[model samples]
Each structure stands twice: as C-alpha cells, then as structure tokens.
Target: MRARNFVSVIAAVGAGVALVSGCGQGGASGSSGDSKVIKIGTLHPMTGSNAGDGAQLQHGAELAVKKINDAGGIKALGGAKLELDAGDTKGTPDTGQSEAQRLVSDGAVALVGSYQSAVSANIAAVAERNKVPFVMDISGDDAILSHGYRYSFRLQPQNSRFGATAAQYIKDITKSKGRPVTKIAYLHEATAFGTGVYTAFKSEAQKLGLAMGPEITYDAASVSDLTTQIAKVKASGANILVVSGYYRDGVLAAKAVQTVKPKLDAVIGAADGAFDQPQFPTDAGSAANGYFDVNYHLNDKSAEAKAFADLYQAAYHDKARASAGFAYDSVRIIAAALERAGSKDPGKIRDAIAKTDLNPLSLSNGPVTFDEKGENTAGLPVLTQIQDGAPSVVYPDNLAAKTIVYPAPVQ
Candidate 1:
C-alpha cells in the first residue's frame, strides 16, 4: 500500500511538470508531429473601422506563409511548415491584449500585427510579459519602442521619422516648383498615431522656416464631417494643407477639402493612411488627384517586389498596398529568424530577429536590421502622389515613378 501511494504521487508530479513545459515552449517544438509545424500569431482589427486595412495585413502574412511552404518550408527545422494563428482585435486595445494572450496560450512561438498604434502598445506589453517576439506590421507611434522591451520589433519608420521626412519632402518639392512653402495648415486625428506625427512635423516645419497654424484635430472614430475644420484652414490663408490620419478619416478629410476648395498651393499627407492606398484615388474621386502622401510603400523598382505584387494581385485580385508589404515582410523576417535559430523557443527566435540583415521587398533606406530598441534602423518613407487615378512615387528622384505636378491644376 505504501509503495502504490508513492507511485501515484510521482505520477501526479510528472504530469504537472509536463503541463508546465508545454506552456513554456509552446507546441511548435513538442511531439514529432507538432515539431513539423511552427505556429505564428497575427493580431489585427478585422471587424472594426480599420477592417479593410486589417484584412490586407492578414492577407499579406498569409501569402508569405504560402510562399515559404511552397518553397519547402523552414530548412533548419527539417522543413517545418509555418502555421499562422490569426486573431481579430476589433480595433480595441483590450481585445488586442486578450487575443495576444490567447494566441500565446495556444502555442504560438512568435507574433505579428496590429495596424493601430494604440492596439500595438497593448499587444507589445503582452509580448514582453510572455517573452514572445512581436514584429509590428504597421503601427508607427514612436513611444511604442520607448518601453525598452526587447521582444517588440517595429518594421515601419517611427512617426517622428515619417513627419520629418514629409517636412523635408515638402520643402524640397515646393522650392523646386517655384512655390516655396510659406504658411501651412495642419490637420490630424486625435490620437498618439496622429498627434505624434503632427508634433514632429511642427518642429521640422519650424526649422524649415515654414509658418504653421490653424492646426485642427478630429476624433477619427466618431467624427463624420471635416468641412468646418477645413473652412478654418482656408480662412487661415495657408498655402499648404498637411493631413495626418487613417484611411476612413483621411478620405473624409479629402472630400471635405474638395468641398471647401481651400485653393492651397498643395495638399499633402504626412504618413497619411488613405492617400497611399491603392483605392484612394477611386474612393476620393477627383479629389484624390494631385494628393500626395509621404509614407512607406513597396519598392516598385525591385524585381522581387514586382513578383510579390503580382502574386498578391493574382491571389486576391487587388493590388497590394504598403501596409500589406510590411505584413508580408514581417512573416518573412520571422521565417528567416526561425531558420537561424534552428529552434522554436521564443527567446531564441527573439535573439535571432535582433540580428536580422535581409533585403526587404519594400522601400527602405537599407536592408532590414533592428536596433537596440527593436526598431528597424533601415525603415524609410517616400513621397507618393496621385496622378490620373493611381498612386506613384514622385520625389527623391531615385524612386520617382512620375514627375510631380505641384500647385496642382484646378479640378
């Protein structure tokens, strides 16, 4: 009887140990069958105001997984195929945190996603707590990387960089067009994403001798009209109007500008979401013409990028946007890290990502590399303009697809 009791106690302890081990390393490195697949979690707002953008992000990651699996999967791990575990945040921070937790509990070795800055912040905290590596696909708030968290990596240029680049582009383009910037009206959404870009733009514009005023803000989720705000911009007598906001709100602002007819020398976007979108021209109608967005986009000149775009279009029957490119690259980055790590341990994967050095399929200042803060040191944004119903690069002569038309002709 004593021997049987001892045996039962030992069995219980072993079971508990197994349970703990399973939770720590996830299922990717488990049983022989499980080790044949790696699970990667992706969080995005698939059912909220930003659903369209979220869908693109998810699809990009999906396409990347397909490409890798088709090419014989991860070579280091015996060609283990990648399995994406997608979660919907519904554009809320709480949902994002919860979804991240669920994904980790379900055995995701790494994570990617979340377009909104606020949502990404919450997801980042979760990643740090769980010691999981998170590669942000589109979130741009600089503060997200300021937390000193080693597990969170951002693929997009910080908001501050985006703002400064936009300002510099504005200065160079206006001067070359013989319509040097003077007074500028600024409009942005009321959030870290929008406000962060605006603050940096204001500082850069000041240094460039560009007077700015009539700064306006709107609730991106609630605001329905921007006419009164744009009317204020027109009354300020500002020669240029600079906008910072997401896709839905961006389109609304564009229509409002068309209605108000501010007659400004130029209307440009500082990391504006809607302007660089493939459907922006059609969605904004004639208002999209002459609209310029200084933001990150796919490198159309790269043959690899061209092939990816073709694959995306052929698979989805729509052109892949800048957001999609980032998401696709995020997956590729993870796969590369997995190959280097030769293990499915989250910590090992995180370390491998820190040393990443691969040429991206998107526009960038250099190859993909992460800094001490997990920020992509080589991320870059370029100026894109809407001409004849399509978005084309038009600045920084090296990447320009078309000559810019400044002081845009009256519609």
Candidate 2:
C-alpha cells in the first residue's frame, strides 16, 4: 500500500488513537509527478470545557488544508502534497503533551495546535525535545514564549499585547475626550489565559497613569452569579473595566455587571472577546453592547478580510471568528515556510518559520514576524466593539466601523 493509503487505513482502524499515531505508519505510495506527501499533525481539545473552541479551530485548519492542497500542494517541494493528522487533546496539559509526543513519534514533521495556553505550554516541550515545529493557532499567554522553546512558533499575538492595547486605547481615546481616567477594575478567570492578561493589563494601565482597582477573579467552570464582584466594581466607582477570559466567563461577567447596573466609563476585553460568539450578546443582553475588545482583525470590511470572510461564510455557512483567522494565517505561514525550506526536515522547517517576517499573509492590524523567543513581534491589535449584535472594529480610527461609544448606556 502507498504511504497515503496505509495512513488512511490506520486512520480508518482507529480514528481516535490513529490520529495521533498515524504519522509515518502509511506507505508513501501514489504518483502525482514527483510530489512528496508531507504530514502535519493537529492537537486540540476535541472534548472538554473548551470543546467548542477546539472544534471550530479543527474546521478552520481543515479548510486551510483543503485550500492549500488544491493550490497545487507545495510547489517548492516539487509539488509535494501536505497531509493532516489530528489528535484529541481533551483540553488538558497532560493530554496535549502526550498527543504532541505521539505525533512526533509517528513521524509528523510539524504540529498545529494546543489551543489553550496551559495545554500549549505542555506541547511546546515535547515538540522541542523531538525537534519538531509546533505552530500555535490560539494559545496567547506570554509565558508560552518566555520558556524559550526554539522548536515552537506562535502565529497569534500574546495576551500581554492584548492587555497593552486595551490600556493604550483607553488612554488615547479617553484623553481625546478630556476625561480624567479614574478607577479601573480588572476582571479575570482563574485560568492561565485570564491571569496572564490580568497581570499584563494591570501593568500597562498603571504605566499609562490609570488608577487600578481591586482585581476580581472568578471560577471559570461554574460561576452562576458574579453579582458580588460586579457590585464591588460599581462601589469602587471605576471608570474603566478591563476583563480577561474566554467566552463563557466573559458572557457571565458582562451579564453580572448588567444585573448590578454599574456606572462605568469604558468596558474592554482581551482575546477572550476576540470572537463575538452569539452566546455573549444573548446572555449578557444590552450590557454586551459597546463592549470593546482587542482582537485579531481590524475591521470586517478590509478587502483581504472581507474576501476571507465571504469565503469562510460560503464554505461553512457561519461567520469566521478570531481563531479562524489565526488558523488560516498559521496554515499559510507554515505552507510558505515549508515551501521555502524545500524539505520535510523538522529542524529546517523550524528555522524557516522562525525567519518569517512581514508576511503578506499577516493581517493589516499588525505585521507578522517571530521574535527569538518564538513570539510575534507585530503584536499590535485593533479594538473592537459588540455593537447591536455584531463585532465592529472601533479603534485605530481608519479601520473603525463606528465612532467610540464610551460611557455605555446603562441597562
């Protein structure tokens, strides 16, 4: 059997286990005019609290794989076709490490996942040990890069950048209105992503002369009522609210604040709100409106972004979120690097990806260049708002869909 056929057979035998173990198990057979088949593995939380996030990312990666393959496979590899193998990490750090190790052992040349930061931290060590490149799609904690893993590369900006952007936006926009920035409350989940952004935003807010208030941490898994915390923020008379966490916690936080009817000047979020998932607006009600966030895309109307968005909707019948953009950009970046490298050698691929700079595939809100620490130097993000029911870019003026709406209407 040809390698591709053998791999397919393995996959068919054990969809769950084979996904991680199918690496080089298949016989590399099939003739498509000097085309070598390259394998890339995906490790994501296929089941767990973050299952929805992982599944969405999986589809995004799949779409990218299909588009790349259809574009004549890597021409630099003499028309080599890229192959995708996926593993279920179950959204745990241990599982991420195990899945990454399995992919490397199975002969996968590169990896593309571990959507959560805690999980990505585990996967990075395994990829480093095996000399395989792990191109991250969503994980944005600064600690992921601080570890100094040479074999890892991040396609998305870090949580720190998002926090910094939030602080700066408040400073620039608030100052323009001649309003004295008073109290700022930072809210976060107990998760690593949340904690990291909390720290980043606190420091940035302080540096920008914004007074900081008590930090509010919530339980990510089960926090039904955050009324107490929201009341505290309201009592503090904070003018600014900086929230950090994924959709679930963000939704709850927003709703909690609305229930308490806080008189706040501005409400901003980090990558946690990058995707304006329906649940946020639905659950949070009018409190969600005018909620600003630092996210991947600057606006929905950029020619490049609009094209991708239309294609995404046509293909999936749903709107593309921040993770989708991260996935697409990661795939394109890896494809370009692999093509430039000209071989499936892991070390070579790592070097090529590390050297990625100002890539055209990079978004307009920022450039795409990897620092020595494996973090993207162009981490600039755009501020967006949940206006009415959709996310609209509202900062970095040229790309904004609407003017800044501060002192959001009280519910």
Candidate 3:
C-alpha cells in the first residue's frame, strides 16, 4: 500500500479526551500527475491552550504542501504528491507521544509540529526513538535542541538567540536614535518558553549593561489580569517593558498598559505569538500601537516572503506572522530535504536535512543552515512594530519593510 493510503486515528485535539479519527489528507485532493503520496505529520496544539498557534502552524504547513503539490509534486519520488497527516497534541506531553506513534503508524515519513515548547520536547523524543526526521516549527526553548537528537531540527532562532537579539536590538535602537531605554521590566508567563527567554534576556541585558526593573512572571493561560504586573513595572521606573506570553497575555498586557497609562517609552514582546495574531490589535485596540514584537520572522522586505505573506493572508485572513511562516518553512525544509535525498528513506532525508543550506532569498533569516546542534544558525530574530493596526518589520534595517515608531505614541 502507498504510504499515503495508511489512515490512522487522529486525536480529538479540541476535546482532548475523545478518541476521534480521520484519513490522511494532504488537504487531500486527487492530483493526476502523482499516484504516490508522501505523508508528513504535524503534531501541534490544535486544541486547548495554544490552539490558535497550532491552527496557524497547521495552515502554514498545509499551504506549503499545497504549493508543492500544485507545482507538480515531488519529481524525485515518481511525482509523488505530498499528503498531510496532522495530529493535535492538545497541549500535553503524553498526548504528544501517543500522537507521535499514531502519525508514524499512519505512515508519516517525517513530522513537523507541536508549537508549545513542552510538547515539542516530547515529540522530539518520539521522533528520535523512532528514527523519523522531525522539523520543528515554533518552540523557542533552548533545551529542545540540547538533547543531541540527530533526527530533530529547528527552523526558528532558539531562546538564547532570541534573548540576545532583544538586547542587541534595544542597544542598537538607543545608539542610533538616542532613545532612553536604561531600565527595562520583564513580565512573562511561567513556562519553559517564557522563563527560558527571560533567563536569556536577563543574561544578555546584564552583558549590555542594561538594568532590569521588576521581573514579573504569570501563567499565560490562567492569568486573567496583568494590572498588578504592569503597575509594578511602572513603579520600577522602567521606561521599557518586555513581555513573554501567549495570546491572552498579549491582550491583557496591552489592556493593562492602556489602563495604567504607564510612563513607558516602549513595549516589546519576545516572540509572544499572540502579538502577531490578527486579533491582537483589535483586542488591544489603540494600546497595541507602537508595541514591538522582537522574534525571528520572515523578512517582510523580501519579495518571496511578501508573496508568501499574501498567500497566507488570503488563506487564513491573517498575516503570515512568524509562527505561520515558521510552519510553512518547516514543511518546505522537509520538502527540500526530500528532494535532495531523492528517496523516500527516512535516513536519507535526515542526512539531507543535516546538510541543508537554504538560500537567504528563500527564507526571512537568509541562508537557512543547521549547525551541529540542529539549530538554524542563520535564524535570527527581527524587530516588528505594531503600526497602523498591523505588525510591520521595523528594525534590522535590511529585513524591515517599515521604519520604527520611536518614542511609541501610546496615547
């Protein structure tokens, strides 16, 4: 039987406790050119806490698969069409493992996903044990790549890189424009992703001689109000505010800023996917204005990135922010490896991935190359400011499509 024909049980990602199922659909439609199908699994938080992030990643992967198939499928595998065998991790480690087995049993040669850092770690372990190539989309925790797992690879800049980038970007902005950003406050969720970024940011900030104001941590999903956190940050006389959290946190943070009207000069987020969400500006209203999200993202100025953004916006009615772009690139990276290997063997695919050197023109970070640690060396963070109700690249001059809104007018 063709690998694509194998259908496995899909978790009821939304409900979390139900045993639901579906067929392997590459968004599944019959294409005349390729009779053979290559199934790629996306194990992500399709439901539960990080559901929004999971759905965005899933759509990005789907879009990539569709684009490949539309372009006459993979020529190396007898014009084999790509198929998606997605599993929802439901925001849990146990479900991530079970779903990993399900994806492999259902015939996935390679896997991509589980956006949450904790879930991604478990998925990475399963992929390693089974010897399947795993392409990561968006989990920034540093430990995910420290395991020495050969089968696991990441496309996004890891935690250390992200934190360092934030510090450097702040320094650069201050140096160039003389922006007074001496003391900064960090308010984040208490997750591996949040704390890891905070740790890295703190280290880098100290190295750059920046003062840390109040370091406030909260639960991204459970926390209802950040009023106290924002008040404390304000009281610390922090001119700059850094936040790390998910969608709800982003909204709450922005609302708190609006309510408290802190004498803040700037508010930056550390790849807190929520700020990149379409609903962020709407939910946060004018408060989202001038907020910058510093994380690895597609180079908006690149023609190729712009084109993909258009496609993604059309499909999802939302911007192809970093998370979506990360997902698309993860799938495309696997596809590129498959093409290079010119075979269906998982081992061959793994080798191709290890040797990957994607041209900067193809991705935002420019030159997608994985180091010995399975981290994309060229994957660096970009600075994006919420401008005119949408997020636009503002710093790292080359990748930025728009200029920074200095002295953020958060009126």
**Candidate whose TM-score is highest:** 1
- For 69-91, candidate 2 gives per-residue lDDT tens digits of 76778998877766666777877
Q: What is the C-alpha RMSD of each candidate to the true structure, in Å?
A: 10.3, 5.8, 6.2
Query: lDDT per residue, candidate 1, 1-411, as tens digits?
Result: 001121232243232111111111223334334778788988887776787788788778877877787788899999988877778888889999998998898888899989999999999999999999999999999999998999999999989998988888988988888887768899999889999999999999889988887789999878888999999998998889999998888999989999998878888999999998888988889988888999998888899899988876765666788898899999999999999999999999999999999888888889999999998999888999998799999988998999999887325
Candidate 1 matches the true fold with a TM-score of 0.91
lDDT on C-alpha atoms for all candidate structures: 0.85, 0.72, 0.77
Stretches of candidate 3 exceeding 4 Å from the true structure: 1-35, 276-279, 360-365
Instruction: Find the 10 residues in a row with the least total lDDT in model 3.
Output: 1-10
Q: Candidate 2, residue 83: CA error in Å?
A: 2.3
Candidates in descending TM-score order: 1, 3, 2
Weakest ten-residue segment in model 2 by summed lDDT: 15-24
lDDT of 3 by residue, 204-261 (tens): 9899888888889998767788898888987888898888888767888999988988
lDDT of 1: 0.85
What CA RMSD would candidate 1 show? Answer: 10.3
| Cα TM-score per model | 0.91, 0.86, 0.88
Model 3 local distance difference test score:
0.77
Q: Residue 91: error of model 2 in Å?
A: 2.0
